[model samples]
Structures are given as C-alpha cells and as structure tokens.
Target: MTSSPLSPTETLASARRTLRTEISALQALDDRLDASFHSAVQKILSCQGKVVVTGIGKSGHIGRKIAATLASTGTPAFFMHGVEAIHGDLGMLTAQDVVMAISYSGAAQELMTVLSVCKRMAIPIIAITGHPGSELAANADIHLNVHVDHEACPLNLAPTASTTATMALGDAIAVACLEARGFQAEDFALSHPGGALGRRLLTHVRDVMRSGEALPVVRESTPIPQALQEMSRKGMGMTIVINETRAPVGIFTDGDLRRLISREGDIRQLTVADGMSHNPKHVSANALAVEAATLMDTNHLTQVVVVDDHGLLIGALHMHDLMAAKVI
Candidate 1:
C-alpha cells in the first residue's frame, strides 16, 4: 500500500529545516571573519577624507545606510550610487578619499567602471563581496569577504542571506573604526544635535537653568510667611531656604505648605527653618540637565537647586524647564 501525503507535523518539519539552514548560513558567514576585516577597518580609519560607499541596486541602499551610521558615529561618510558613477557623477570621487565598493558577485558592470575610474584617480579602494576572485576584489587596497553558503529563500534566489551578511560586515567595519578613533557619545551628539538623543546628550544644566534673581532663595532665619511670599513670587514652585552666605540650608515648596495646613502650629511663629527640608537635593551648573531630570525623577521631586562645589546656590531648575528644553 502507498502512503498518503503526511500531516501538519510533516509540513512544520519542512519549515524548521529551512529556518535551521538559513540561521546556520548566517552563523557560518560570521565564523569565517578574518584579518581582512581588520584591514578594512584600518583603511577606513586612515582615510583623510570622507568614506564614500558605492554599490548598485540593493547594495546601494545598504551603502547609504552604512554611510549614515558612520557619519553619525564620528566617521565622515556619504554614498555614491554605482550606476551614477559612470555618468557625470564620477567627478565627486577624489584622490584624498577612500572608497568602499559593494557587490554580491563582484562583477557588476557599473561597479567595474567606477573601480576603473578610482584606479585612475589613485583613490584607495576597499571591496566587499561574496567572491574573493571577482574582479572587484582583485583591485582592492583592502578586501572584505561577506560569503554565505545559502539563501534564506526556498528558491535560493532572493538576497536575504547575502544582504544580511553584507550589512553585518559593514556594521563590523564601522564599529571597529569607531573604536580606533575613540568615537564618543558627545561626538555622536554633535552630528545629531537636532534629534532628541542629541539634545539629551549635548544639553547641559547651565543651558537650561534659571539663574540670578530668578533663583528662589531665603535666609534660614526668615519668617515662614515671607518665605511663602518669596516662593510665590519666584514661580518655580519652591524656595531655596538659604543661610547668610546665600547657600542652600533647606527647601520649601507648595508641598511643604500643604503639609503646613491643618496643623495646630501657628503660621506667624513658624520660622522658615521649621518648614524647610534640610540639605535638599541640588545639582551643579556644569551638570547635564538630564542629570537634573534624573535627580528629580529619583527623589519624586518637581525641582532642584543648582549650586557650586562650595554649597552656594547659583541656579534653580523646575521640571517644566526640562520639558521646554526637551531634556526629558
């Protein structure tokens, strides 16, 4: 007797087999990484001018993304489409620059044409491809191989595995270069100051803090009623209860006043020190506003006093100040 086509279990087994093959293919490509990767990293770091990543089709799209990541991380970079290089755009290529050329097979006609022009210009070239023997790899100043044994697609035609390897390899090169140059978060922030992460990283407490007469401060012996008036006039929702030196002795807020009400204590007899919280949380003028935000968030507070190392109060900041500065 002949057996019928198997059940759902058999179909699932086929799918698992495909997934395992693709995952292994990606892992195999990763394990194959070697010295050529370091060579590529050196070429990028030694580059005096911008990194220009060029490729045709899908590789071109990935090239643009790689360039963006490099630029944002402190290595200057831009993308030149491979096909456009053969047109009038080859003029953008300069001898001072290093070129990163991407091709899966390493034989794309447009890439070959651009590589030839790069040779004539004496610009050093780095090649990324699956085939080591391809013409594109032969002319490289440094060569990086992104070989993978199989495609994730069942038909073995789509670019999933190859592109993944290429992208992974590009990221490896970028990070290696970033580490060599000691690229820092502040450096990244300068490249992206208009973005939220940039603002969060670059903005300092001095840039967003309220200083001078805007500071809500009262001496330690001041009457509670007058200190309440000072808090009201400052509009920061709190007062820096201070000493004779204008250093913060404590703090009083609407929170303190709310706790004041319904108590049998006499409002007229209460000294500012009686209602003040001693040694209130404060930040320095040079500190990051984001740090101030963290201080407020961690302490369940709405404001913080800004002081110098000597304990003299120099500034005050409220949570809304952070919101307005986009520090939150």
Candidate 2:
C-alpha cells in the first residue's frame, strides 16, 4: 500500500532531522576517537601488503568505498566480500597484509570465518563496529567504534546514521594514512591518470604542443602577408618568428597585424619582424602543460613557443592545444 506523502513542511523537517542526526553521529565518533585509531593507522602504514577490506550488507558497501578511497590516496587496498573471503577469496590475503573488517553489530558469521583464517596466518585485523564488546572488536588487533545513539531511520532499524558514521570514519582513516605517508597531489594523479587532475599534472607541453608541419613558423625576414598565410594554414592565429638557427625571436599575431595596419597603412612593405612582438614567451618542452596555461593566462597570451633547455624552438603551443588536450 502506498502511504500518503509528507507535506512540504514535514518533508523539510524530516530532511533536517536526518542531516542533524548524521552530523551528531559524526561528532560523537570524533569525540570517541582515541589511541586505537592511531594504532590502526600505524598498522596499515607498516603493512607491506595490501589492505583487504571485507564486510557484509551495508557495511560491505561502505567498505568498498573506503577501499577505493584508500587506494586512490596512496594506500594499496581492495574490497573483498565477506562471504567470498570464506569461499576462496581469503587466499588473496597474505601474512604481510592487513585486514580491515566492518560490521555494525560486530557479529557477522562470514567475518568470523575470515577472522579465524587471519588469526591462523598471524595477520593483523582492524575492526570497525558500533559495539566494542562484540567478538569481532574483542578479537581484533584494533577496534574503532562508530557507535551512534540511534539511527536516523524512523524505526531505528536501518543503517542510516550508523552508515554515515562508518563512511566518515573510513575517510578519516584514509586521510590520516595519506598524510602519514606524505602523499602528494602528483602521487594521487598517478593513481587517477584518467581524471582531470591527472591530465593537468601529467600532461607536458611537448605532449600537446604543435610540432613538425603543424607548427606555424616564419622567418623574421618573412613578409607580413606570408606570415599571415602561415598562421591561417596552421589555424593557430599566430606564427613564430625564428632566426636562421630556428630559435624563436618574436611572435606575430592577427592582433599585431591589425594594429600594424591601423598605424602603418602599409603597401605590403613590412616584414614579420617589423610588426612582430619581441621576445615571445617560451617554455621548455618538459614543462607541464598546465604551467604553460598559467604562463599564457598571466601574460594575456594566446600562444607560447616550446623550446629545449638551450632555447632552440621545438614546437609552439596555442591555447587551443591545451583545450583540445583538456589540460586547461
């Protein structure tokens, strides 16, 4: 049977109550944190093998997220279903590995079976449960209590606030380990290479800069009209002016041409050097593409030349290249 929906006022009140309850649970968990939390972090840090996080039901779902957070933040971890662990997945564990088992009641039978195997193998177990007195907590090398006074569920039977507390505690653990290991953003980007942060941190100017025939190049002596043709052919809106040694000396842009024409009223007498902006900004090919983007933004430039350490021009980077690589 469909129950009557809550009135708007009642619905807002209900949402507020849920949020307040979860916030209270998190506050309580924070207040209750003690030395055991430190021990858990140290154990995981000292572990030579991966952290195998296992649980059942809602705790299992939370465990999977916790495992992923830990993995992405520099810890090597993976989630193993409690039932699967008993039926052959336990082989994934090693003597050097650590087990992080979660259960609100701390009495999951599957977890108990896995705990037995961990005991025999002398592997350390870190337990997260709402009950510190339960067998899993009592037997674990370290116990983290996520106890809440009551769940946000109207019936107080659903996982609600307890699950929120569990997930928050898991995040706390991951962040602690991350800080302890001195994990940096570059390290995180390595793990998440397909993510936006990865693209920004890992992509270099050489990886995205136009090179070879795609690079718009012109000699300082090249006529302004011919330089404009090179810019159009490359579609970069600008052409790099190079000396005989192919070192970028200046850059001529569409804006520069328009300004020069407005001032000179030329009858096609000017060379690129006559109108080009001197000392064009350049970055080493090994510099990060994001760094090049920063340089462009700071200087109000549309393009920057890519060069070797010796300042020999290798390629050119237009803002469009950064956009195409999603590095901007």
User: Candidate 1's residue-wise lDDT over 1-328, tens digit each?
Assistant: 8978968999898778677876776687778888878877887888888899999888888888888888888788899999888888888877889999999899998999988889998998999888999999997888888777887777878877788778877787788888888888888888889989888998999999998888888887888888888888889988888777878889998888777755645678787777778899989989888989999999999999889889798899999999999988
Candidate 2, residues 1-328, lDDT tens digits: the string is 7899899999999999999999999999999999999999999999999999999999999999999999999999999999998889998999999999999999999999999999999999999999999999999999999999999998899999999999999999999999999999999999989999999999999899889999999998898778888989999999999898988999998899998999899729789988889999999999999999999999998899999988999999989899999997
The clash count of every prediction, one per candidate, is 0, 0
Whole-model lDDT, model 1: 0.86
Per-prediction TM-score: 0.85, 0.97
Off by over 4 Å in 1: 1-21, 259-264, 297-300, 323-326
List lDDT for all candidates, in order: 0.86, 0.95
